[model samples]
Target: MPAGTFTMGDSSGDKNRADGETPRHEVAISAFEIDATTVTNDAFARFVEETGYVTEAESFGFSAVFHLALAAPEADVMGPASGTPWWAGVKGADWRHPGGRDSDLDGRGDHPVVHVSWNDAVAYCEWAGRRLPTEAEWEYAARGGIDGAKYPWGDQEVDEGGWRANIFQGEFPRHNTCEDGFLTTAPVRSFAPNGYGLWQMVGNVWEWCEDWFHPSTYRRGTTAEKRTLVTDPAGPESGQSRVMRGGSYLCHLSYCNRYRNSARSQNTPDSSMGNGGFRTVALRVESQA
Candidate 1:
């Protein structure tokens, strides 16, 4: 995106206020190069093959998997996560075995690799000579230059003119109608690209951002006289959880209606789940010669 200023945060007026998407503010973003799609299993596989690196999930011998998508047998299943019964901690669940030990990336190499933690994504970035986009940059790119638009395509609903994203169509965590031709994750390029030519920016998987999450990050440093134009806001200086943007396939209107441009979520740097993944942004290296 070229250097430009745009209003950031919930313009819809219907977002979950607790998610820190409030206090709508203007932000000026610098031009940066971002990947058109989330990193695929194939891409990650190359990173692993070359570096011989093991992901956090692989090290832990388990990762969170949606109950409906669990392919592990009763022996490999470790029960549901606390509070979110829809997710089960399955042993042997990693990026390679997304569902479980029984699952493989046979024909799904092009799909976004899940069960990747923020630390894992940063490891991949280090190997790939790239970095995760900041929360501000991610939102700016997802907005596609459309100031304060709800969805990436515009303010139109996901199911309005057709399936604009790969989110739950039926009752979430129970039955997915697959109205969008996807029960789990669709290909990275399943939906139409946003105006910035970025694909699946708001669905398929939650992309990690390089920012510590805080509920009141937007409300800081504001006065009656002047509205600060936060240029390239990098989020809080310290927090336990990093920001995650672009809701995943598990997102539904009834529950996680966070598949919009301004929606936000967070998780610990080491947390990994079936619905989590990330894309990288190229680092601008200044010429030394």
Candidate 2:
């Protein structure tokens, strides 16, 4: 995006204040180039082939999968994750086998590659000579230059005119109506692109950001003052978990309505799951004689 300044954080009154998406602030970002869509399985496969890199999930022998998307048999299923019974730690649930051992990329090569941890994303970035967008950069790009809008497409409810994003349509975690034509993940380019020509920025999967997450990150430092324009705020210097944005297919209005421009979430760097993925960005290098 071109170098510009915009207000960041939740402006909508209906924000999950606990997620620290509040205390709206002004942020100035420099010019940078970002992927139009999250990394697809086909793109990730090429990275794996080129580097022979094994993802964290592949090394861990298992990864988190939504219970409803589990394709593994009873033998491969490892039961639900603690506190979140909707997720199960299933064996062989890596990017290649998103559902479990029984699943494969197959015709879903164009879909965002899930089960990729923040660390895995970083590895891929290194191999590709790119980097994950900072939390601020991600949000700014996601906004698509719409300024203060709840979503990338200017605050019209996601399903208002039709299915704008691939999110839960029915009672979440129980019965997915698939009213949006997707139960888990739709193609990376399923929805209309934002004004910036970026697709699926608010749904399909949670994209990892290159920033440590802290509930009070915004309220802790100089960014706390709305008058101060935080220039390219990276995030907390140190934290246990990294930031994740854009929500995912499981997001629902009745349950997790985080499919907005300012919604935020986090996970350990090494944690991988079926609803997680990432995109990359590159700094603009001017030509020189």
TM-scores, all candidates, are: 0.96, 0.97
C-alpha lDDT of all candidate models, in order: 0.91, 0.91
lDDT of 1 by residue, 1-289 (tens): 7778988889787688789897788888887889999999999999999999999999999999999899988999998888999999999999999999999999998999999999999999999999999999999999998897898899898988888999988877799999999989999988799999999999899999999999888888751136877788888899999999999999987889889999999999999999999999988634445
Q: What is the C-alpha lDDT profile of model 2 across 1-289, one tens digit per residue? A: 8789988888687688678986888899988889999999999999999999999999999999998899998999888878889999998889999999999989998999999999999999999889999999999999999999999999899989898998988887799989999889999888799999999999899999999998888786778855688898888889999999999999988888899999999999999999999999985545445
Q: Determine the backbone clash count of candidate 2.
A: 0
The clash numbers for all candidates, in the given order, read 0, 0
Question: Looking at candidate 1, what is the lDDT of residue 199?
Answer: 99
| Candidate 1 runs further than 4 Å off | 222-225, 285-289
